[model samples]
Target: MAARFSLTFDSVDAPVLGAFWKTALGYVDELPPAPSATRAEGLAQFDLPEDDLPEHGVWLCDPDGVGPHLSILNVPEPKTAKNRLHIDVRVPGHGSPDERWARIRAESDRLVRAGASIVDEVDGQHVVMADPEGNEFCVAATSA
Candidate 1:
């Protein structure tokens, strides 16, 4: 079996940026690690602010325990260039092209409402978007 892995993002605010990602990716907040927990365990425990915003902490996990965990960390520099690697939000679709597009559009709209803006759209392919921090990602419908 493949080894477990996750994605890490550098950010100015881990909470705000991580929240956008959690909503965009349908992930849940990862619990803060135990005081005596190992380093890795502590990484899982992200301390969210009371309002869950304007706070300090990092980490989100797939509730179903299938998808990868996400780690957001603070950095001194800002994003000055396009991302060499970005996420693709994959939505499995079946049946006609219309059905596929409908599914993809629905997810795209959901992300927009969650503070993501569309960057580009490809016919029967994918919708590119940027998070509130200008981190680009794509939403796509799977081809059978």
Candidate 2:
């Protein structure tokens, strides 16, 4: 039998990262309940009820084109250090480092505007970025 799992990201801003993944993965947003306080409260935040939340949670597809899901979750604590494991995204084509860098930058800019942070730029072949939750992901030039 095949096993399945959901990858979770501890995010300071769950809705932002969730929106990003929703766009990148074609996944729909699970509607959450309104906060207990009335809209005038201005401090009451709301989210999906535990039972109403999707079983799959929030996730996106593997950047490699592999079908594994990448899930992001909201947590109380912030990420204090670099991730022990990371995701690498390969742009599906071949090119020189400069060429690759240009493409990667274009894509990275899009992601940045969408709430991801560019952590670093290395050569023209790769760039390291973090999602709104702070989980690291890299974009690399690829022949595939």
Candidate 3:
């Protein structure tokens, strides 16, 4: 069996970045740990100093429980270059190429409204975009 793991992102503002991805991927904030009523409470229990914890970091999970968990944590430095590994948001459909491209374009537009910026379009197959903090990802149309 394959092991499950999370994808972590370093951000300047974790909650803001987490919100953007949650909207982009249709994910939900992961529930706080047991014995805590809220994420803040859970973090408080750790008793870590402010310096030890990333400001307002958030954890998200796939609503269908299929995709990997996401951890967005704040860091001091800014993004300097292209991502070595990135996400591909696939919007698959059954139709002509134009119809399929429409689906992909619609999703790209929605993501743009959710604080992502378009970087490029590749041969009408995919759109490259960057999150608010400049993390790169793709929106692609695939055969269903």
Clashes of each: 3, 0, 0
User: What TM-score do all the candidates reach, one by one?
Assistant: 0.81, 0.64, 0.90
Better of 1 and 3 by lDDT: 3
Q: How does candidate 2 fare on TM-score?
A: 0.64
TM-score leader: 3
lDDT tens readout by residue for model 2, 4-90? 755667676666777877654445543233543332232234464554333324545545544556556566587999899876766
Predicted candidate 1 versus true structure: per-residue lDDT over 1-144, tens digit per residue: 989998998887787888899888789977666673454455446674344332445778999999999988877689898999999998885878888888989999998998899999997678999988889999987658
Point out the higher-scoring one by lDDT: 2 or 3. Answer: 3
In angstroms, how far off is 7's CA in candidate 2? 1.9
Question: TM-score of model 3 relative to the true fold?
Answer: 0.90
Clashes of 3: 0
Each candidate's lDDT (Cα)? 0.82, 0.65, 0.90
Top lDDT hit: 3
Give the per-residue lDDT digits (tens) of candidate 3, residues 1-144: 998889999988998999999999999989988988987778887778778563558899999999999999887898999999999998967698888889999999999999999999998889999999999999997646
